[model samples]
Target chain A: MSVLVYTENWDGVFKKLSFELVSYAAKVAEMMETSVTAVSIGDVADDELAKLGNYGAAKVVKVDGNTTLDNQVYTGIIAQLAEAEGAKVVVISHNNTGKALAPRLSVKLKAAVGAGLIALPSSTEPFTVSKKVFSGKAFANVVLKTDVKILTLAQNSFEVIEVGGTATVEASTATAGEAKTTVKDVQKQTGKILLNDAEIVVSGGRGLKSGDNWGIIEELAEVLGAATACSRPVSDEGWRPHEEHTGQTGKIIAPNLYFAAGISGAIQHMAGISSSKCIVAINNDADAPVFESSDYGIVGDALKVLPALTEAIKEAKNK
Target chain B: MKIVVCLGNVPDTTTKVKFGDGTAFDKTGVQWIINPWDELALTRAMELKEDAGNPVSSVTVVTVGGKDAEPTMRKALAIGADDAIRVDTDARDAYAVAGQLAEAIKDKGFDIILTGIESSDYNGSMVGGMLAEMLDVPSVSAVSGLTISGSDVEITRDIDGGKEQVSVATPLVATVQKGIAKEARIAAMRGIMMARKKPLAVVPAAEVETLTDFVSFELPAPKPPCKMVDADNVAELVDLLQNEAKVL
Candidate 1:
């Protein structure tokens, strides 16, 4: 019997989220009185797989080749492996890949699943876990009645732990089935920080007035080394790309620092960013909902306040 | 091409969220709207159908909800779905919802299925993927762009740092976000009048076992009111950010 952790690997290496998964699964395995096994698919080096032991995996299983991950194929493989290993608990990251697979695995395994989980199980008896609901406005304590359980940990929700150790790597014979979709092209935003992985984010909204005035938001973001984002209205107005929009209908972010300049925090907008650690709002309206949710607020026009704040931060960094 | 656009009725974005006793949510007086994301998907599908010499044959909107949800289904038809289906039951979880949808879709012979990436209410973001897996079809998650040509559909999906373009054969599923359609269209009076004659089937919910049970719901703690600072004193705001908020 073992606790299984799906350690996602990309570009021949394990992602940072994979390390965090092993660290989390290790603790859960200890409580469950079982060893932790890390599962990897696609092109990953053996040495890299072995290094996961540092974060506390007892063993690593690699499903090799340049196979592109399709949700259907990966879910089948993981579910079959879990049953074969008698894994009582399965852990997955609550990111794009995980979100796409976890629910399918739960249904296939007939196991209860808790997704976007913010913390460890409150108790294993009834197998209760907490996950964000109503966007980020609320949390629900969900109890799983099934014998097996699946969990997808929310990004940045848990601390990563590493204890010195080593892991045994085993090459699996599991091959993916035929895929229905084929990749045509991949267009990467090569130079800019990705929103999901960014630690700091600077965003603007309709208050910027025009696409031409977006230079100030970009200048502030550049100074802070933060990814740029925009409100739904800004994206709708075509002032910014749709991928850069963060809100109820857009990307959900949890950056350490979030700057909302010229953005009036609509409830929809707040839903996507409420998880951010520290939100700073610069808006002309004192009554903007962004101020109500932000940790700090400056009552002024974003055009004037943003440049001043950017200069101040630049000065502070110099000092 | 026949398209199945999955819809979910949710409380309006502006609705104040309150938890009821036990496992229930306080839905009293909450005005429901067609989920904004699903509405966007429906609008985009309508645009494709309305274009000159378009290839689309029909647009069907499906949902897992009770009679109270029929109005929302009607709204979907008014917004331009050819027909609507409401599975009569309360949706327990994403898995159960997807199971019901898959059951309804298995015999429909839909060439393409579209759903919002995540519903505004629960934000589970898993149903579309689950449906795809159940039906044994190709699916793209959170697609921002989609173009259909013959039996091949090209989709643009946003990853953490980049965008990927993938092509899938017919009988494809796509969980779409905002960029699939720049704007959602309002129902014209003629569309609304026509929607009255549209077929809306209320099928009994399939007996699928639910995976998770909710014990309770809790609202997030109220944040302290914002501390208004003079706009000119950027230094003070900076100090607060560094010393207090520690974001710096």
Candidate 2:
């Protein structure tokens, strides 16, 4: 009859998505008339787990283990916790870690699970959950009739709320499963925004003509403190790294503000970014498909439009 | 090495989305196809098999969908999968799908399991990770490059801002991301002709766990009309972004 929320961390620090999930779980806990306990696994520090209390978690459960990104080990631990706590509902963030853990925990607990959830459960007979479908092209409502329910909320789907309070931290020990995998090294990208977590994104397309002329795009991104992205053709042409590509065939992203400069929006590209809150397009072709999806459309040469936009951003920030 | 690529039949990315009276999707008139991410996973699996000089004995494609998904399942066969398995069910929930897949493959003795990072339709991106957990194996997600040497697999994943490289033992699961490999080759006329002869198996979905349920579906609010700012009005555009949108 209790609710358990998985508090996600990265390199020992809590991620923003953790707070967002906790905020979301708090609401569900309130509606269900149950207390919410936030759980963190694998070497999380005491002070860090304590921060969960501010987000409405009544208590924080910290399980210490030398953990890698192994789903089996994490799931085993979560299953034990859920069973021990007699949790009726488990809330997790639909990020990399949650995506890996939620389904396994559901299987182990014999609980129903829903992923890509966008909002709190509707207060209806079946208690349906809303989720994004078709790469943000559509929506689907899922109802969980089981006594135990597992829900993985989409990242950035719910607004982060702050309810100032202190969380009680409790240390719990669990059996550690031997990892079948070995991690020899961890190489991380330097000086790049995590594309998924970026608030502002500046993307380019084939209209930039070549890789050498990417300075304008980078400058604009820099001025706006935004992440950089590109269209499929731009990546295929080797004008940008494949990781920078954002489209249906590439990475799908939904940022607060997306500036698509020099790219024609193909259906595939639109499919990936159509969920972005605000879209601005800068292209010479007035009929470009990107214009159709953009909140604001500027019909002009990108080479000219980009520099102007960058300068404008810099000036506005300074003022 | 034996690799299993889990596939899901999903609505085409371009299909118009409509929700029924409840939260479940209205499937009428929606064209179904193999999820695009899963296609990337299958293509990568096939590539790894080829690069290993056919060290891979079998490439199995697994799906949890209804009989209507057989054509899409057959397409995997055309793309070089040796065999296919369709768990007879239309369970769209990730947990149920993972349970069915884990049950079918748990005893299959697979060394590697590959799946798309997320399905284009559900965008759940949960099964691969869950399956690995249920099978008690290590799992990496959003892997862009994978190389196998003996029992160890080296994977490179795109993390926030940068990439992470991990080396794990065999019997591992990986969710493949785009840009990990070249575009998947479409079935050639000859390949298509031969796919009809490939072995396709159907099995009832496992009854393991039930968690969430769909209540109804709702379309996102229609987008507002585009407001064009004259190219000369750059300042006004900036003002709107800063004041109106409050996103600047």
Candidate 3:
């Protein structure tokens, strides 16, 4: 039996999350005393596929030519690969691809799935895993009673250990089912830190007053190399695009450091960001709910306090 | 065009979360609502149906849960669904839930199926994709915008950092997030009265064995009381963040 990881490839290379998945799969494989294999689909380069070995994958199966990241088709292929390899555990990153594929794969393989998993298996006896639930407000211990276990690791939840090595890439071809939906065009936000892969995030809220004031928020985020997010109200108000919204009904992020400026901590907003390792809230209202969930609360106006904090951090880093 | 909007009944976000026997959720005193995300999907479908010169015919809401889920289903109908289907079963894992839903929707003449990206209760965004696989249809997730013209469906879905436009034929499934509709509609008196007269069918759940078991539930560790820094003491806050929080 093997531990199989679905390593997501972006363009021609594997991103940070892909390596993290392999690193995690390696750990699980060690615990089971088995090897780990990675499955990559679409048009990724060979050297990129080989780099997965640095993280722990022993073998890489590259399905050439498929470009679109269609979850419906990938699910069928992964299910087939898992069966052929006698994979006992399937590891996938809890990103868009995994979110779309894991449950469907579980149904195809008759495997018990733990989605948005936060940590390693607590016990392998009953195959227990811990995952974020209730939009990160709580945790649940889920047991996969079935023989085959499928799990998706929460993004930024695990550390990546790099051990220098290279994996053997094997070319494989399988029928990717016809896509009923066609991607007419792909528009990616370029030249900035991607939110899902960001380690630190600086977010704003309606308290910023208007879209023009977002320049200050952008400056702070740029200094920190952090991705920018906004409260739901700000997004709804069109001060920021809807994609920047982070909350219970929005993107649930778990960066190591989350900075919220001018945002009152609404319960729904907190639900999406409470998983961050350290949270800092800056708001004018001393009674704002964001403070209750933050590690440090600055009872000040974000407009004044954020500029000062950003300049200070820039100085500290330069020193 | 017939569209099926999948429904999930979730505890109101403000409900103090507590686990029963540490195994499952305690249902008492929990006010259930049509999951905010699903409400968005339903409202969007209704708007498209009532759109000027649109070809949409009906919107049907589907859910897999016990009788406790009825009120939430009723709310969907009032919001504008023409009919409803309840696959009567205890809430199970995503796979079983999707299986029951797929079984219920298989023979239905629905050309489009919609679901919230994930349920707020479990936060599993897998059902819609799984349903697509079961029904052998195309699936899209995190759709922020949608438009339907005859058999042509166009959707705008959020990707890693931006959004993409996808066009697909009929017999497609989509798990939608917000931005599809400005707001979920509240059932008016007439809509509420009409909902009571609409068709609400209860069917036995398909026999699919659940895969995952909930061992226990626990709240996350609480944050320490906030360390307040005076509005002007930005320097001190930075020092605390660097030395104490170690996040700088």
Give TM-scores for every candidate, taking all chains together and pairing residue i with residue i.
0.96, 0.92, 0.97
Model 1, position B86, has a per-residue lDDT of: 91
DockQ of each: 0.77, 0.63, 0.76
Write candidate 3's Cα lDDT for A1-319 as tens digits. Answer: 9999998777777888888899999999998999999999888888889999999999999888767767667887898889989999999988877887887788788888888887889988889998877777678998898999998998888889897868999988876678666788889898989877888999999889999999899999998899999999999888887778899988888998999999999999999888898999999998999999998889888999889988888888887
Please give, as one word, the docking class of candidate 1: medium
Q: Which ten residues in a row have the lowest lDDT in candidate 3 chain A?
A: A174-183
Q: At residue B146, give the lDDT of candidate 3.
A: 94
- Pull out the clashing pairs in model 1: none
lDDT of 1 at A91: 96
Candidate 2 lDDT by residue in tens digits, A1-319: 6789988678788877889988998898888898889888878888888888888999888888746666677777888888888988899877666766776787677777767677888762576777776666667777777778888887767888889978899988876577654566677766877777889999998888888989999898888888999998888788888888898767767789999888888878987788788999988998887888889988888888888888887888889
TM-score of chain B of each: 0.97, 0.95, 0.97
Ranking by DockQ: 1, 3, 2
Candidate lDDT (C-alpha), each: 0.86, 0.81, 0.87
Preferred candidate (TM-score higher): 2 or 3: 3
Residue ranges of candidate 3 with Cα displaced over 4 Å? none
Estimate candidate 1's alpha-carbon lDDT, on a 0 to 1 scale: 0.86
Taking the tens digit of each residue's C-alpha lDDT, what string does model 1 give over A1-319?
8999998876777766788789889988988889999888887889999999999999998888636667777887888788878999999988878877887787778777788876888888888988888888888888988899988887766767988889999988775577666888888788888887778999999888999999999999899899999999899888899889998888888888999998999988999899899898998988888888998888898999999999999999999
